[model samples]
Target: MGIPLLENRTSPAGARPAERARRRRYALLAAGTAAMLFAVGGRWDVPLAAWLFPVLLLRFTRTTGPWAGTLWIWAAHIAAAAFWVYESALGSGPVVLAGAAALSAVQAVPFLLDRLLSARLGRWTAPLVFPAAVAATEFLITLLSPFGTAYGSLAVTQHGDLPLLQVTSVTGCYGIGFLIAWSAAAVNGFWQEPSRPSARPAAACAAVLAAVALAGGARLALLPHDGRTVRIAGVSPARTVAAAGRAALARIPGGRQGIAAAPPAAVDPATTAAQDDLLAATRREATAGARIVVWPENAVPAQAAREPAVIAAARAEARRSRVYLDIGIAVYDTTGPAFGRDETVLLGPDGAVLWTYQKAHPIPGSETYKPGDGRVPVVATPYGRIANVICYDADFPAMMRVRADIMLVPSHDWREYGRPHTDKAGLRAVEGGYALVRQDADGVSAAFDGRGRVLATADSFGADRQTLVADVPVRGATTPYDRIGDLFAWLCLATVPLLAALATARSRRR
Candidate 1:
């Protein structure tokens, strides 16, 4: 009887206007959300847009049909989120497009699932389902592609909001993500209904967010007493090498004539110049009263383990300068086919080897070296408990979840992705509650405090070599994120299936 009445009530022709209007609304909302995401991304990083995009997307999803929501979300994410990777993979146009499409499709899946589940569970549950499903998806994506970790996630959009960003230290970005998504969903539900049913969820979400903000404020206020300042210097070698090459070519017989007169010096000669430049920068920084001097990834020309002179020269420089020196070099395996591992060695002020760490998480395609098998080490230093990781290791949270006051990262970034890459690495410092000193060979050499505030930055692409010096605070406040490590993400993962099942049963009963 009910089925026959429902069938008689609705006709395709009668519903066309409403359906078309809904579709138009969905399209507008999708476009607006896409624009917001693009604007508030790594380039601009506006926090308000982070909240607005999710709210609009949630409204669109709630109102639109499942298939339409999925298609719209895929299109929007492809244009906004996935396209960011194109800069890193510009060489293969077709491959880049295909990857973007694939990533968009994957990103769309969670939103689609959330819409379907919310339709069954009712709008009240939307707030809970959206964050859980999306977080689970993010965690799964990270498992498949390590780069998928909340490196450039929407949480980063709030980088300028220190109190808001403090949530990362407790929940590893997912906590903030959950709050953002939940607030959006709750607001959408209230705005759509405008009744008592929606009021409860909206108020609940507001209360929870207020609590989070208060806790963040309290954490900031009650932070551990400011520790001693460590004067650190980060040197970029690319500009230095370029400067030296120009000087060398100028001394040649027909230097002003043409490119033909310049020897094939872009390779070995540039490497030699970079090594010399790094050593010079170390000496200069040491003399300038820097307690710690850091070099960019692969600062040495060849394998340091193979050549005793290379290590001897660095040791001599450390001794002469009387500063703690950290240098990144390739360490070759003695037993095999000279397969090298990327490594960073820390030299104490007395020229003694303090700590050595191999790059644990190497870039997949570019790095042809074995990953480090050792544990993440936090060595004690006069400044504080200092830890070191080389280049790609900074991307993985697990590789950096050590108890350290300061983290020294020797990074090498591609020209296009320098700033965002450096910023993402700084997010690690935020999560682990430590100061970061990141020296990049061909990128932005930056220093960030525990609050993820950029203390100093230097451009490695400029004509003149620049070294960044900053007095960075050490020994940050203790964070639950460092202690438990992705617990909030794991809880989200565990809740998704249960929520789906409950929603299905509730819908069946209805």
Candidate 2:
């Protein structure tokens, strides 16, 4: 026998009111759960919540009329987005709210698609619709949106779960998202139709997840860490020095604008003390046996004219200390149309300039630097094949797919985004099978092995000095994702239309 229909016209007219009331309760619960768990930074961000909210929301939509379901889901999404904005560093301005609303509208499309298409298909094929829609939406957002994969990715919520995260090594983060969405769809199917055959899909999803976890665990356990390791150190200015520099800059005549428009002579003095501190820290770390040293993003701020001198000082330091130095600097240009340049200049032991990489994806509204050509720079060193991408560039998986042993990310973040942002960057290490060293100014800095295991961490906010040292593997592991590159997301995107057309054709036959 088919499952008992709830609240539809097929039900007795007298029972309709109670059924609708029950479904409304489900909708409310779904909305509340989504609001609690949707955002990146929040107290209620439980991983299980990511798997659960979708199920309840799907059930509510499946039982309701198309228009009612669409409206309710949109409202739920809007509430979730607003909650996220409130928790985030992004201020809740009218423009941000409008953008969030627009994004919420897009986010609700998967639910609408599931509501419209699932009933038309057979039980075996029905559960695929929601996941396909969700994955497609996420993939499109990552591909086309300027925000990149910084927001709306369910995989980010599950960053703490390493075993499940290994799926990203093959399918990118989109695979993990797909599995989560598929689990929701599968569970809902089993909930609606409590028959033996209907249970197979849910069981299959569980099996797949279990298999993924087992395989991931095996990979993590079996991966040889006995290989050669290199000592690397990440450095940022002392809290006191950083504060003093900011104070000095704040005294400029035009306030924030003055720092950018001020003459090189005026800006140089303000930042000189902090830059000296960072260079000194690098020398100290190098003395302590760190062959490669890194400075946090914009650890040195200089005017365009003074930047050459800044580089010359860093080069002299690296040459004297006989260490490789990755120097992060912000070069302000008073005459140029662009505000400044945010970049990392790599210097070899011989004081030779290796490669200079500019930040490719600057944070949407906050950063005004001219972006780089989106190419990751990799060079072979004695330690390993090293690659560098500054800060927000790590968020884009497509750009981060370089075949390098070590990925150096120089970042700067506020207190609210520090740990979560670093954890998100670590996922790229797992995906690319490379050791990742993220050195952050005024935030949490971290280093992770290729298997996503933490090597070391330093919180600039908590510590007096932001200096982190870690021994990371010299050789990078090979992963399927690095070669195939988003094939699973592409497949998910391709399946949505085919499933919809099949469902449409099948509905006509009935």
Candidate 3:
């Protein structure tokens, strides 16, 4: 007879290995959550560079222990999302978790789905499979909700890829996002240990590199620099104080007068008119025989049809100066399908309406302002065909689809840290192979050519008034992005069927 030995056990007071294991699991989950939250809120400017998303997820997901990787990775996403929820839930004004929290949940879906595949699928295909799933998730669901925003999307990593960004003008930003996610996923595959099963991962990494080289070719083919004369306008009809009060008043659905409330701050009687006059001077500087005159958002508050005096002056200026007015003014759509208090307008050189782009994106402080459902149509004139995107519309990748040789962004940013917005917008112009004209209020008003190079810039931030004039080139070549819109996103989406095939093949072999 042989004696049997019992397994070792810890006493109630002792630190057990299981306890430490549990703590590790909890820590991974926490990391995943933190990553998601940070990416979603735009709180961190250099989010990916500071904390590479793929490496973080891979560390948590590629663990050897059973069920450990999934928990840790999921934790990483959830913890990150919670940061966004907690900040908003505790902030000033009313507490709300509707958009921010829901968006966080939406982001977490990919991690949960990825883990399910990662468990059964061989590590060989991690690069191809993982990026595909992520890209698809971003694309298919990007337009899922009525207000789904890719504002903090994973593709933002390509912020440094000026040439690659041009692809968005043709296909849209979602396509660019696909490649970026794939690159990160492929990178993680290379770092995962246990080399015998890492072949497919290497292949995935190859795919990313190949795609980047292809993008480089397209960028090289497009002429990146051109010097074209572009006249821009910067109009400010009201002073800071009057504009503030008027902005507050502009919010309520109105008939120009009889708002039952007072402005946010009293208009400073000393300098309101002086500020408007200063804007007039800047407008003159911008329109002196420039190819196209630019305008600021909400430069004139009066309804377009009702402003005979304002229209007469603008019309006379365009005809006499022989300069086209792309001036931003408020227009009414009393009987239109939708009702908005104000819209951005474009007046022609012949003293007629060339095109009018209603503000598509509405932000806080604008009263009863509804979004303009339609995209801005590209207008062809003697100067060139131009696509007019107003204010918040620049953030959307879909807006890049409208056909135009050049882009005109009319914006007003009195708020500080407006340079990032300008930089991002300017990048979009470069990515799409078009000259970008921006008329800004206290911002980086700029012009960029088709190859994503800056032509001219009014580098003065928070200035009293400024205008930038330079030659705006009209480029015609469509980028690969235009031809292959969101192929990366589509590849990501196809992961669902791919995993099924892998499982079936495994069963058959068995």
Model 1: per-residue lDDT, tens digit, 399-422?
678888899998877677777678
Candidate 2, residue 422: how far the Cα is off, in Å: 0.5
Model 1 gets an lDDT of 0.72
Candidate 3's residue-wise lDDT over 1-510, tens digit each? 232222235443455677666666456545645555555433344545423565556555554343555544544545554553344232322223344445545555555555555556666554555556655656654555433332445544454456565555544555555555556555555665546566566675666557765775676575554444455544444345435646555555543332322241322221234334534654466445554676677555543244455556666666655666666654333444333344555666677767666776665323345677657768887666877877666666556655567788887754333454566676556445567777776556777676566667774444544656777765545655555655545655776578758856775676
- Clash tally for model 2: 0
Looking at model 1, report the run of 10 residues with the lowest lDDT sum. Answer: 254-263
**If ranked by TM-score, best first, what sequence of candidates would result?**
2, 1, 3
lDDT-superior candidate, 1 or 3: 1
Clashes of each: 0, 0, 30
TM-score of each: 0.84, 0.93, 0.76
Top of the candidates by lDDT: 2
- Candidate 1 residue 333 C-alpha distance from true site, Å: 9.5
Given candidate 2, what's the lDDT at residue 157?
84
| Superposed model 1: Cα runs more than 4 Å off | 1-16, 19-23, 36-41, 86-99, 150-152, 238-268, 303-307, 330-340
